[model samples]
Target: MTSLNVTTTTLYMARTISLCFLVALMEGLDLQASGIAAQGMAAAFQLDKLHMGWVFSAGIFGLLPGAFLGGLLADRIGRKRVLMASVALFGLFSLVTAMAWDFNSLMIARCLTGVGLGAALPNLIALTSEVAGLRLRGTAVSLMYCGVPLGAALAASIGIAELAGGGWQVVFYVGGVVPLLIVPLLGLYLPESAQFRNARESAPTGVVRGLFREGAALPTLMIWVSYFFTLMVVYILINWLPSLLVGQGFSGRQASWVMLALQFGAAFGTLSLGWVMDRLPAWALSALIYVGILGSLIALGLASRWESMLAAGFVAGFFATGGQCVLYVLAPHFYRPTIRATGVGSAVAIGRLGAMSGPLVAGKMLALGTGTTGVMMASAPGIVIAALAMFYLSVRRNGAQID
Candidate 1:
């Protein structure tokens, strides 16, 4: 390529990643909003743990179809269009969540908000991977994903600040409005995927057959396994950690601090681990992330002191969220551009099942008097399974590269 071409490609990649990062930021904030607002939301709606669990699960359930349909649509229409629509949908519902008058209304709003949030993710991953190409895919995706944690941290800060006179609705209000503001910017500046456009003339593959056919079956299954378990742990922590901390005798303010630390750790982990993923051996990276997750979970369960819990939260966020980023990075390698979003979306949709299950399970365990330790310990076996599956994928990926 000429210097001019190289410069243009660089510019395009920068633009795409930057805009995607902004969207990821809003997505992250909204994902964590319910958790941050849980206490107030529960009190406002007169909800118990089981009811809260349903509330959490309701939003996650929307993610399942959103991811699949979003990716499918991106392949047929375009990534940029699907992403913008997803953002607008989530933003609108987030506002509705703030204005919710009853439990049913709240659940309905969150579920719709979740659909938008879920749809945005696959396109974000697909767009980042395509623009960065094979070489910088990990770094670029990680960099974009870092927005999630930072945005979560911002939400935590809002919680800590007791914004809008500490009204829980304030967080939702912010989450809703900012994404709407971003929609026009995306429409004006975000470029469609060059790879997707280039591949448009080729015969499209059947969605199911595309994912399962050829040599993709095993990798697809493995990715699903890893995503399911990894996200289960991540979502459990994201949605439950604050409440768990409060249950353990800490003040809500203290829990917010720990949550903030966790988000900061997540941002750092996402960026650092993503860079390492490109340079480190896949098996080694897999080992590092899972081991960190296990250790963090143990520490979180055992820690009693406020400082110790904060530290544990940081470590948990680092490995759990970072490991999730690894899965997102690896997914694009298994499919061509024609179905890349479909493949990633399918895996993400499967992961959402895990995500939905985790909070409800924890809610049940807590209601049954099992406590935080039991919840943390129960997650261990799944992490081990996820580790082994990821190890297999890492080994397989070493010998395979997609254009």
Candidate 2:
């Protein structure tokens, strides 16, 4: 490429990456914030682990509609406006959540925050894919997603420190405050996805129905199933692994440290996946990751020991999270600019149901007296099914259409 082309690419990539990173950061904060605060909330409210899971799951539940509505809103109005609105809403809910005195109140606040989380994700992914060149789109999008793991890691580290000092309430306070600080920067620096801008005039009003009109039904369904299954398993790991480890005889501090390792491993997995995606099909790459997840989960179940548990945690993080990164990268290609936001948002929204289900499943597993091995193994079917669905939908098999 010419110097001018290189410069433009560099600048655009930076902007895209920044937006994605921030979105991922916000998502990480939103999801992990509650996890960080779990113990504190439990003590303050005199609750059990299952109830605490509800608090964590509430935000995810809210994300379901937030993803759809945010995408639709972005399609009708614009990505920039939707982004600003969601960020503001998230900050507001985070603030409210910090002030909440009871389980019910906190649940309501978390649900609202979930909406913001859901709304922000699809548009952010769309933005990254839009600005990236076609050749580098997968890698660029994957790199942008690194923000998720980094944000989660930040949450874990900060959460541990704050909880140590001021208790879990401090974790919520930090979650509420930090995003508000980023709000000014987001307003000043974030730009609309270039593709969204170009397609604004031609975009449709009805997001869901419009997605299915042009032979989009089958592909859309496949994407939804594949995305949903993968995320359900991934969210389960994120929400319960630490506590599960505690059940396996590790100390609470050690469990938290293990969780940190998982998140960090996820960060590396995303970066590596991005690089590999440049040379492979996104679906195929995802399939490979899912296979790894199945293997890891089975091994984790059979380990019956600490060193093996730690090793399993790392591999599960690598496969489960790394696979989800592919869906985010592949999202932009599934729709034209006119409805790209809606498509991506709709996919995320649908997938959020699985995200919601993940913890619920884990909760049920815990209730059933299932051991650590059973809990970890439960994720395998979701991964395998999603992989099969995706392989069937690939362009390689049937001349499939992405947009």
Candidate 3:
């Protein structure tokens, strides 16, 4: 009987982990497909580069409100239900986006999609962490995050391949359809976070405030800083790398390939970071990752030739993506279970502001001819600030009790 019980428990955990990964995959596809379709979208809408950026930013605006509401809903209703509903909503909007007749329609659809995407992430992160044991939590979270790079790469490949035959609309169609297919699977497989349920039952008054008011404030702030910096770096890479390479004299096809290399490197980096996180100090690991990123960025900026640029792109992806993954992994740990969703949601939403700003600022840099060296140097400060914040948070973690 004991053997059977252990087997059942193990199987259940495996199922939980798998479902979490599936959620990440679906969300990644939903979130990143548009960026891959950006050039085609600009051409279709007769938008200049700056105007094209608005379509992307509009989506993030929707995400802000959606994330807040979703966090509340997760605590009030249930994480599993919210997760499934958000995925469905995102998928539906994606389909609408594919059919958009003009830029305004596309912006509206993207905003709606953003709302769903924003809501989905916190619940998913909270639920995944709840099921995972402390010993393996980082691994479980990172496994789910591996979907991010995969989804991004999938979008890029589909976009490039169908540009001639199907155009940008097909990219949105695939993004919409794929998540819709995953919705039923998620509903069937995903379980509510047990911790969320328990917290809802026993949480004290003003639970959300406790994230900052209680001793948790220090770690929470650290998470915010790390999340913001990591996201900024990531968006800069994802939104600008292909164009950056092309401007450096690489062919369009070669630049596209470089982008893919970054995504692939990110996937592996997430897995490797997850493996090392438990064994090493969190801040130390994060700092090391940033150091690697800083070096890669410098190399990328100074590389006189294509071979070096490609190599630097791969390394940049490894560090940038992995660094962000760690922030997500650490978020839940920074707060008590009662406010876990809120904590994660706030960090993600705030971090997204930085994400939204990255490409815009980079565009400004291009306009000013800031050059790769200046742009790359600018990113280094963000990393250093985030690392210092993480170090402080680690100190606080030592004194606090995490529920």
Tens-place lDDT per residue, model 2, 314-362, is: 7877777877887776666667777778888998888888889888878
Where does the lowest 10-residue lDDT sum fall in candidate 1?
200-209
TM-score of candidate 3 relative to the true fold: 0.93
Write the residue-wise lDDT of candidate 1 on 1-403 in tens digits: 6999999999999999999999999999999999999999999989999899998888899898999899999998999999999999999999999999999999999999999999999999999999999889999999999999999999999998773476999999999999999999999999999999999889365766788887999999999999999999999998999999999999999999999999999999998898888678877988999999999999999999999998999999999998899899889988989999999999999999999999999999999999999999999999999999998888887665886
How far off is residue 61 in model 1, in Å?
0.9
Model 1 sits at a Cα RMSD from the real structure of 1.1
TM-score of each: 0.98, 0.93, 0.93
Task: Provide the clash count, candidate 2.
Answer: 0
Instruction: Please give, for residues 153-254, the per-residue lDDT of candidate 3 as tens digits.
Output: 776677567645777787678878877898888777766777777778787677678777856777777787877887887877776666677677886566
Highest TM-score model number: 1
Off by over 4 Å in 3: 398-403
- Score residue 90 of candidate 3 by CA lDDT: 88
CA RMSD, predictions in order: 1.1, 2.3, 2.0
Superior by lDDT: candidate 1 or candidate 2: 1
